[model samples]
Target chain A: MQIYRFEDKKPFMEKLEELLKSGFTSRQLEIYLPHPDHEIEELVEEYWPKSKLKFITLAGGLSGCSAGFAFTIFTSLDWPLITSGKPLVSIPPYIVIAFELTILFGALFSLGGFLLLSRLPSFKQIFHPEEYGNEFVIKILREET
Target chain B: MSHKDTGVVNQEVNAKSAAQVKDQMERDILAAIKKPKPVYWLGLLITITMTLIGAAAWAYQIKTGMGVAGIRNPVGWGVYITDFVFWVGIAHSGTLISAILFLFRARFRNRFNRSAEAMTVFAVMTAGLFPLIHLGRVWFFYWLFPYPTQRLLWVNFRSPLVWDVFAVSTYFTVSAIFWYIGLVPDIAILRRVRTGWQKLAYAFGSLGWKGTFKQWQHYNQIYKYLAALATPLVLSVHSVVSWDFAMGIIPGWHTTIFAPYFVAGAIFSGMAMVFTLVIPMRKFFRLEKYITVDDFEKAAKLLLFTGMIVGYAYIVEFCLAMYSGNPFERDQFIYRAVGDYAFTYWLMIACNVVTPLTLFVRKLRRNIKYLFIISFFVNIGMWLERFNIVVISLAHDFDPYAWGTYTPSIIEVAITVGSFGWFLTWFLLFSKTLPVLPITELKEEAE
Candidate 1:
């Protein structure tokens, strides 16, 4: 892995555009900035647009809702007792739990997906320039011949 | 120096080069984390002492039982529940500033969102303690959760208290994630800037963020959605909290307006707290350039808006009670204004409604001294408002024979004071550790 640091964004962008035009795969190059930039993100997205991130969040939320409903409804049935003279399978109140669980699992899945997709908690040292946090740096992984 | 003396508004925004902007932000914000003054330690010492006192009080209560807390059959929810509601209300503005303002693209929030979000987390932590303390059998607190037991026991899904458990816990989870996600880039900055133990800590906390466009893209996407998810919780959490009272059959507690009323009141109290905390912090941290009077004025406008909403809720509550001519509701409203606890009711009105009205004066809104003083009043008034709502309603219930006035015991008062100490300790520690200002976001705004 070769890391190049640029004091200005212009050189970084030019190098990025050159790398992209040369048909380098998105995985071969990583661009880091001091802060988020819309245009650069657009350029990155133009190359690597497909991501399965949302599916994890969606699946987690749906399952969370299902689990929440099952837990609340089944628990009442297990007891076979009524407190407020309402139906044993009271759906109105149970929806609160479902809603809460939906958010909880959705958030957890989204965070999990983010960590997994980003390959985070990365203990293995990669080529990261110290200036990358303040300035800009682009890292390119060389293909072994 | 007074912020006005700094002439922050006169500084030219467009004059600075990109490098200059970066340097200035780094110098100003990072100093708060790297340098500690004597005042910081003094404040920490005081808060720690208060927290210890509160813990001792809780210990005393546990040893003697709930009888030591002055709660009786009539006024069952006393200062502990009031403190719970007040702290929960104070937690609202953090989400409002971080999530709601981010959704609306309010640039002003960039300066103060980190501190506000931290307040939200700490305030919620403090608020969560009250329910446990109120539970005479503090050890039985886990029973609030729905877990299958040998007795086939389960929490009733029909209870608003159960809803509160889910709502508050989810709110905390989402808010904490939102807060931590926002910290990643800043933590990444600290990772490179610090050394030794601090470097290792930031290294782990930052999740190895590189400035890569790809990482930024994913971070931005996830953050946006988290903000989206948290927005509804800002409304729902407090609404569910209101239901804790609204679901009760007590005359004053059974109003349909409780949800919106409580939500508005929460935002109002929370904003006042933002003012209370930020005014002193900006001064102490010498962040006048970043957190200007203009920022305070904008927040004051919001404080005024929510304050008006709260004031309107109060009036509408009384009007509805009178118009309904339901003898029970009418009597309860009358009792609130003129009963034994009428001092608290009037105090709530004066602090929340009357004091906030002064902000309509442009001069007062911009004046730091006036704004700080008024915010202090609002904090006290909001606490009293919760006190009036919780205690007054229960005291003057439909059964006239059951009517009774109640006062908090010394233990309850100590715990209440301790809750502030606990909250302040976390906040003060946070200020010294994290960049109180969102350094990355502030730089983004500067550019």
Candidate 2:
């Protein structure tokens, strides 16, 4: 079994560089930390066909809001209504629609963000020797026995 | 030292201190959330009990009938409607503080954002409840929606009350969504920071967000877009609420001035509400450093500005009433000033006008105790402001025989108290569970 912690970029690269040069495959997993270089991720795909890897990325609030808004508005556009001799798509009335849509979207998006990132409804947390840290640790892992 | 040289040195020193104040301000905010409080969840308990009691009272009001409160021919909307306007008006400040300030690039909002955002959510929650509570048949409340039915019941499209259903519901939904969405990245941060149930909750809300470039790119784009969208809500929401009265045939309620008038008063009372909540929470949360004197001063400045507008509206209303030379309108204005409800009118003036006018002085703005005292009056004043608009208008019409008084029954008062409880409870729970401050948004602002 083997364990590697990705800290600074230089150390992480050096370790990966050694792995690439030495051709150490199998029974290993590189824990890809948050905001890991896309090229390195690409490299993993190119070089190691079956070697195990885990990835975690950091996301913020606005993204969640957008997603939620998009889901609600697009999904419910067909909702029927008539008022004020104005077009169903009038500006003044639509202002209300837009406001509600934006808010609903922002909320659901946040909830969605939490769900996607956190991997919730998760009851058991196993200390399976193979742990990855994206926040402070970046990458974490365990090698096969 | 030469006289000219002495003046120059003092000016330079003042400039140096001004620069120092900004730097100190930043460091102070950074220290605030980091310095933890004992995390007394008493607020959480109190708020819940209040919410449940509110719920029970609302349920009882519905089951018994609208008569459970003090609604009759003269006073159609007593506490419930007054509260609806009051709570909706209160909802204004959150968006004003968070969205308006952000658009204008005001850095002072950082300290109050979490509290303000939480305020928006709770205020809206409180507002949303009144509509249902006011609905004598709460069960059939959904009938207000323009849904196709076999019974062929369609909501009155011409009625401003129906417009209110659209405006208030939309405002609350969107604002709540905006508030929650802004909270996501912070939820992720909290997820990373804590363990056990806290971690679980944050993790759930964070939605597996990894804060990568693609995500941040999308997030920033969406946030900017949403901010743009939310800004107009500041105008539209209160205007729509005002339309509820404006569309009516009542002389005072039907005035064209209502839209702008209500919006101004909404903002005035809204700022006061924000002050009332922030003053206490800042102390309890030990957040004095972040929610600094500057933020309070700025808000007070806004409160005064709105107060002036409200005062202007008062003057204009009387002028309009007299100039129009309609005895009915003139009589209504007179009754409002010196009528049976005179005490409420005077209270409104004292809180919204005479008192907040003191805020023109910077010293009183920063005086926390004074802010709280004034804030209390502002609240009382703003509430009366709505009361006078709704009840007083109804009490005195063109016909003297219809003129009547409205006194809230015990149930009406209970429900109002319960709404406050509900609002506070939701807020307290939220503050503890979520990162009130949008750490990500603030980080962006700082940059």
All candidates: interface RMSD = 2.5, 10.3
Instruction: Tell me the TM-score of chain B in each candidate.
Output: 0.96, 0.89
Stretch of 10 with least lDDT, candidate 1 chain B: B1-10
Per-residue C-alpha lDDT of model 2 across residues B158-267, encoded as one tens digit per residue: 45566577667666766766676677656665566556876776676765555532344345444454566567766777888888888778878778888889888887
lDDT of 2 at B281: 69
Least accurate 10 contiguous residues by lDDT in model 2 chain A: A51-60
Docking class of 2: incorrect
The chain A TM-scores for the candidates, taken one by one, are 0.86, 0.36
Clashing pairs in 1: A31-B212, A31-B213, A32-B211, A32-B212, A33-B211
lDDT, candidate 1, at B55: 99
How much lDDT does each candidate structure score?
0.85, 0.66
Candidate 1: tens digits of C-alpha lDDT, residues B147-244: 87999878899899999999988888888998998998898888888878888888888877665666676777778777877888789899999999
**TM per prediction:** 0.95, 0.74
